[model samples]
Target: MQFVIDDVQKKNLTGKAVMNMSLGGSASQAVNRAIQALNNAGVVPVVAAGNENQDAGNTSPASAPNAITVGAIDARNDRKASFSNFGQSVDVFAPGVNILSVGITSNTATNTLSGTSMASPHVAGLAAYLMGLEGLNTVKAVTDRILALSDASGATVQQNTAGTTNRIANNGQL
Candidate 1:
């Protein structure tokens, strides 16, 4: 994360770059430190909330403060994916099932993938687009817009014991 942020900074693209990492594991010092460094460098670290169907608070980047952790929902029914991780750590849920995107081979190639990994990209792209429009200059600024624009409607995230709701991603808000 630091390396990416450093490279973006070196290229003077820090203001235009928004970092999103769609992977994580059990929380650790190194991961938290990296997230902090990314934040310090003005890069929003968007990450997957996981697909283990467990509390995302247990995951590394998801557990890291200031990280935007995304969960998954099925586009077919606008419902939470049974396999998506939840809990207070999840910042938002986005369409993940059967999402189409570029494949590994070439720009013309495309494929479908699922899980929170697929969901995070939607939020990351929206946040980046809003940043460009709003002239957002910091990670917090960009993330704030993304969160503020989120919709609780059609939400399918299972509520945590604490009763807080993790909103669903709404491209319509864009």
Candidate 2:
């Protein structure tokens, strides 16, 4: 995490880069500080809320207040995935269940996987797209735009626990 933060700082990629952190563990101040540093450097950090089925506030990186923590929902029905963590730490939800993606075995190979990690990339990609499309050049600008564009009415995530937002990441496409 610090490595990426350092590189971003060194390269002065502020407003030009978004980081997707699909990994996390228990709460760690060190990780939180790194996330803060990344935000201070002007890069948006997108993190997975974890697959613990508990409060994401207890998870590092996700718990880091500076990051845009993401939770998982099933694309088929917009229901919260059984394993996705909840709580206020999660800023938004995205499709994670049975998501298809490239596989390591071969160029044409693909695989279906599930987890908050998968959900996070959707928001990360959206962040980058927004940065490029709208000329958003600050973390605050990008974050606010994302939250404003999210679909709270369409989320309707079934079984989503208390404290988490109903908003689901959206790219503004009809």
How does each model score on TM-score?
Answer: 0.86, 0.94
Clashing pairs in 2: none
Candidate 1, run of 10 with poorest lDDT: 156-165
Model 1 lDDT, residue 72, Cα: 88
Q: Write the per-residue lDDT of candidate 2 for residues 7-83, one digit (tens) a residue.
A: 87788787788999999999999999999988988889999999999999898999999899999999888889999
Count the clashes in each prediction: 0, 0
The positional error of residue 54 in candidate 1, measured at the CA in angstroms, is: 0.6
Return the top candidate by TM-score: 2
